[model samples]
Target chain A: MPAEGGQQALNGAARRALDAVERTGRACVDSISAFGYGAALFAESFFWIFRGRSIRQPVRLTMIFEEMMQIGIVAIPIVTVLSLTIGVMLAIQGIYTLSLFGAESRVTIGIALSVTREFSPLITGILVAGRSGSALAARLGTMSINQEIDALRVMGINPVRFLVVPPLVAMMVMLPALSFLSDLVALFGAGVYVSLDLGMSLPAYSDRVIEVLTVNDLLHGLGKSMIFAVLITLVAVVNGAGVTGGAEGVGRVTTRSVVQSIAAIVITDMLFVFVVTR
Target chain B: MGVEAVNSDRSVLVEVEHLVTHYGARKILDDVSLKVYEGEVFVIMGGSGSGKSTLLRYMLALERPTSGSIRVLGRDVVRSRPSELYELRKKMGVSFQSGALFSSMSVGENIILPLKEHTDLDLKTMEIMARLKLEVVGMAGFENLMPSELSGGMLKRAALARAVVMDPKLLFGDEPSSGLDPIVAAAIDELILRLRDALGMTVVIVTHQLESAFKIADRMVVLDSGKLLVTGTVEEVRNSSNERVQQLLNRRVDEVELDPEAYLKRLTGA
Candidate 1:
């Protein structure tokens, strides 16, 4: 009986070991499958975008307009306010440091360079990701669980073309537009802080901002914003369009969309800074 | 009308031969072979998880079978290229169980979707066509309303309107009468018949509702446990000698026999 018990225990251990190996294998397969699915979806979106553009598949102009208004126009007030605050805070911190070195007047150059080249685009990307990226994922995820995506497929409509391209085009247009507005507002904010709090002339602050900002800086910031736009749109769409498991899945993927978009934005921003600053 | 009054010269519209499908390790359809005739209501009836919907998906060319062939409109669905499938799909229409109307678009927009995609009809013509279909579905004045505003029955009707708008050669509806009251269910069933008769489209409906299935099915295919149990006329199925067929038709659940020792061990966690 004792020998039988020992043999059973050994068999149980082997079974658990096999179970662990099976679980690990399943997880690996799942990860690879998800990665492959996301890549394929991304490629399909682009195929419809550039190829379908030339072929003249009916693009919904109204939807592009609507998404543009939602992502860019509706966001104007909040983006403007947040950018101005960041500008003021950057100037305040810079002014304190500059004062210690007796280089107070030079703070405008620092504020202008940072806001135009990095802060404006980065901040706009973060905000849009939280606002519009999450919205896209949540909306698409709900549509998916409701079988609207499958319905589109059965109707001979390409889901990527019908559902994804409008937001994509809207992002391409609006992200740069938002970034431009952010740049202007942040500069104005820095000017306000310099003239009022630091006792510098408004005209002098403006002159320094203009002097510090080069054509290269403006292009770099806009270029970064454009890439950020693509990342946010694609990540949100992939998460949303791939949702399963009904309501809870929508929530789960929505959270994933925001988290993934933000991480992608930060990493891309770091790379852009590394390359562009060099 | 009995079987004799229905024309016997109809051509086959959809053909499935020895079809097999699997979901992971579990077989979902096993050697399910059937034919759908043109201008007839072919109902595939089964309990949940019996693979009727999966079969419909295959017939619609949205899924591939593990083995065997499905030919819709004389084209092998498994071997068709994407472009070929798209062309074949244009000849077919499918109404989903949940209506699947674009929530963002009004009912009018949904009905005119296929027309806009496949035809160069002017906005006025599309609108008129959409209105005409809505009227046919008894939803004439509800075109401007969004999908969210429609009741379940109205949503299903509107979805049907959208499906038939392009006058497809074949119409596949999934669970048309599901979640409806018997009266509403009967009305949808009648609509299916009218569509088949008027449009001359082959109709394939996958449903679990026996009453609706019996009321409309010209010929029925019954599935159980991912396998075809029987396929025959209503009377033939009613008179079937097969134990599984009788079990299903009489709404009897099979008793599962378990070893008493094992049952007790599981229950007592010993």
Candidate 2:
């Protein structure tokens, strides 16, 4: 009887181990399929951008303009303040560290390169992700809950065409523009600090910044911002369009959208830096 | 159970065969079948969670069943591509439970959206069409109001205006009388009947309100626990011999003999 009990226990352990493996496999498959579904949705949205007019359901230019106003123009004050603050702090730290070695003037080089090639774009991406991405998810999730999306489907209108493409087109256009503005504002901020702290002339600081900044640095940051835009919009649209369970589900999906967009931005930023620096 | 054949002379606009649907692992609809005739108000009534809404969604082609054939307007909705489905949907209209008006758009804009998407009509003509629908729904001057600004009944009216703005050949309403006072609910029922008579549109509704169902429906199918209990005219359902149907009609509580062991297991999560 004891031997039989021992065998039963062994069999139970093996079965549990197999069950765990099966569960893990299924989870992986679910995730992969979800990712594939998201990709298809993204592709369909993009396709609608080009083909909508032929079907007489064009993505309205006025709608795109409204999105740009919401996503870009309305965001200006916050972006400017945050980027400028970071720029001043970076300059202060750069001067203090470099002055220890009697090389404080090289602070201009550090500020110009870092602000143009990295900090400005990264900050703008994160701001947009947190602000617009969360809003998109909430709006879409609520629409899903209210049956507005389903209503649109039954009306023969494509939600992606009417909803997703405007924000996406606006993001692609606005992210690069906003990054350029951020780079300029941050440099101006650093220039102000240099003039006040080091008793330098504004023109001299401007000359130093211009000498250090390359066209490629500007282009690279703009490119990164564009990719970040795609990531933020994609995550928000997917989460929002797929919401279930009602009001609480909207909150859950909105949080998930912001978190996922930020993570994607950071990881892609790292990959970008590794590639470009190499 | 009281089951009667649908009027063959009217011609069927929607036909479902052996439809089965599951929500995750739980069966929501089991081998259900029904037919809706053209130019008639066909109601699907049941207790909550009886899969009436699910069946409506299937007929709309908004969702696919696990196994079934659904023919709507003579097209096999199960296998239609998205493009074909959209084309089919142009002739159909649905009013959701809670209005579901696009919050961002004004009532006028909401009503004209389908026109803007599908037609090349000038702005003036589209606005005229929207105004006409608004007048029909008794909200002629509320075009500039946002959805949030409207009361619940007004919202439903605006939603109804949008649904019929395209003059669809078929209309589906999911619980149109819900969440309203009895008077307002009756008004909605009256408007639905008017739409059918005025526009010559076939109507399908999923509702649990027996009064509104009886008032608007020419024929209906009553469902319980995802199973169809009766499909007949109002009098047939009212006189159904099935105990469950009688209980539902009388609004009486069901009495089930308790199994103590099973009850204990359920209570204790065993």
Candidate 3:
């Protein structure tokens, strides 16, 4: 009887331990399922957005122009200022480092290539993601929480077609345009620094930059900007639609949109480098 | 109960039969059944947490019932294809308790959304239709105003205008009188009645306001604790002998004094 009791106790302990393991495994599976569900929803919504036709042409064009003005024209002064400061610092560092080999002319090519091919697109994407992406997320998130999306659905209007498609199309088309403007400002800033600090004539330094930065370089930067724009907009809309907890959820989605956009931009930039360089 | 006999001649708009819904482990609705005939007002009355809104959603096909069936416009809502559901939803309109207007769009745009989606009407025609609907809802010349600019009563009216912009055959309103003054609520009720009289649309309203339900309902159903208490005309419900029905109708004196937990305990003798 004593032995039987001890065996029963042992079996009970084993059963409890097995149940604990099973419970933890089930919890992990549930979490993974939720994550997969969210990801699938995001993917489906992305396709739905792409499939939608923009109905209001004039309104869509106006929105595009407005977004470009806000993201590109209004952003020029800051980009120019930052580029000039960075150019001056880069020139100073380049001169100091290259003087070890008595090769200061390389500073012109270095700053030109770096700014046009990478820094210009990267910095501009970060700034725009902070401004436009957060705004998009907050606006759409508020709409979701407020049941405006449901209203649109009941009205037999596709909310994605009405709300997201226009903005996404605008972003994709305009980001490349903005990247071109950014590259121009960055090159101009580098030229000014080269003329002042490197003792090179303005025309001569500008000629060298034009030579070093080929059409391939411009295309590469513009391509990255387009990808970054799509990423930012997709993240914004997906996070916005996923928001469920009301005002705090909107705020959380806005923050997540910015952070995720920046991260995606960086990762995509790396992928672009691998492809383009290879 | 013989809704079939009444609807044998006319087209039956919505028929809900043995509808059951569960939220996780809790059954929110149990074997609830009702019919909304054409050109009539049907109201669902229940206290808070009694699954009135769940029933509305089920009727609207926004939610799938765990068991039983709902036939809206003679189509099985639960088993219908996506295209069929979309077409069915186009035939119906819903006005939420919170108005649910897009804050970014002007009142004109909100009204024009449905017209833009389901019709090939030009901008001029759409604008004219929007203005007409706005005027019908007593919101004339408020086209350019944003939703934020409207009062609670005006918002509901605007939402109603938008809801009927498509000229839907059926209208579902959840808590039509909630969060409004009595006067405003009365005005909304008047508008609903006028719409039914003028357009001959089937209306289903989910409300807790006894006065609004009594005033507008041609036929009514009351739900108590996720179970159907009674289905009758306003006078019949008012003169009900059921204790739950009595408690609900008399409001404060009978309801608050008879605590639900104590009643349950006494009934169970535990």
Candidate 4:
């Protein structure tokens, strides 16, 4: 009886360990499956886009235009304001630090490089993640709970093709444009700081910015914005697609969409940085 | 309208055999089997939690059964490929209980959604078809209004318009007359009759409203506690002497006579 007890305890310990590993394995498989679904959705959307007028003209045009207005046009003022503020702040800090070595004149190059290459795209991504991403999640989540998704299926319309593709296409096209706007506004703000605060001429500041900014820098930033846009759209749509329950479920998934978007954006940004910097 | 006429030409459209379903560990439907013949309005009536909607969802291929085969329109929905399923769905339509109209779309657009997706009909033809469906449902002028703008009755009618827009061979309605006044509900019941007459359509309606059930059901099935208690013509079901069926039809709550000894054992966790 004592030996049997000992063997049973050992079996219990092995079972516990096995269960812990199985739990982790299940989580890993779940995450990978989710990613596979997301990638398939992304690829299918691009396929529909390539097919062009296969979708009715008015529907496709209206959807893409509406999404562009939401993701890019409506976002202009805030993105502009944020970029300008960051640009001026960077210039102020750069000049102060350089002035310790009497190199305050180099603030123009510093402001142009940092704002153009990193700040503008990152901030634009985060802002769109909060605004458009949350709205997409909430809207889709509510439709799911209301059985509108099922209605679409019963109607023979693929919900992902009909509802999600336009928004994804819009985000892809708009984020890069917003990033460009951010860079322009930031450089202009920095130009203002250089002329007014640092007692340098605007032309001189422009000259320094022009000298340091290269096509590589522009490509790097714009490329990052595209990646961020993909992250935001895929995360929002995926989280929204999986939503169950009711109104509270919609809210929960909206929050999850925002969180997932930001995390993915940061990780992808790091990968891009490592590639570009190398 | 007679049972013999229906059974004489009975070509089964939806065939379910030994179906079982579960939501988590709790069984919702158990070995329930039924047949829906073409060109008849088959009503599945049950009290709440009796798995009527689960059965409807299975027939619609919205939920998969744990152990069964469901053949809809001669296609095995459980084993069909997605492409095959899509083709099969194109031949049928389902109107959900919630109306399930696209909120962002107007009533006209919602009705035309199926046509827009499946057919290359010109906009002019589509518009005419939408208006025709709306007129049939007694909502002719409500085409321009959004779903949110419609009353409960109007919403149901508009949803019906959408469901019948394609004039599918089989239509599955999940409570078309629920939550409306008797007059409005009666109108919906009549609309179902009109759809059958106009389209030669087979309909499967799931509802708890006895009045609606009696009005349109050519053949009816009564479900009690996830089991089929009776499947017969409307009059046959009305005459059923099954105690559980009687309990449902009369709305009698099953009275539990409790024993203190059993209650004590349950509470003591023995």
Query: For candidate 2, lDDT tens digit of each residue in A143-231?
Result: 99999999999999888888898898899999888999999999889889988999888899999888888899899999999999988
Residue A120 of model 2: what lDDT? 91
Off by over 4 Å in 2: A1-27, B1-6
- Evaluated at residue A92, the lDDT of candidate 4 is 84
If ranked by lDDT, best first, what sequence of candidates would result? 2, 4, 1, 3
Best-performing candidate as measured by lDDT = 2
lDDT of 3 by residue, A26-61 (tens): 989965764575466445546655443442212345
Q: Kindly report the root-mean-square deviation of model 1 from the true structure over all alpha carbons.
A: 2.9
**What digit string (tens of lDDT, one per residue) describes model 1 on residues B79-152?**
99877877887788889999989898999999998888877889999999999888888888999999999999
In angstroms, give how far residue B28 of model 2 lies from its true place: 1.8
Please provide, for model 3 over B55-106, each residue's C-alpha lDDT reduced to its tens digit, 9 standing for 90 to 100: 9878877778899989988999999986677788789989988899889889
Deviation from native of the Cα of residue B71 in model 4, angstroms: 1.9
Please give the TM-score that candidate 2 achieves against the real structure.
0.94
Candidates arranged by TM-score, highest first: 2, 1, 4, 3
Predicted model with the maximum TM-score: 2
Docking outcome class, model 1: medium
Q: Lowest summed lDDT over 10 consecutive residues: which window, candidate 3 chain B?
A: B1-10
List lDDT for all candidates, in order: 0.88, 0.91, 0.83, 0.89
| Native-referenced DockQ of model 2 | 0.85
* Model-by-model DockQ, in order: 0.75, 0.85, 0.46, 0.54
* TM-score per model over all chains: 0.93, 0.94, 0.85, 0.91
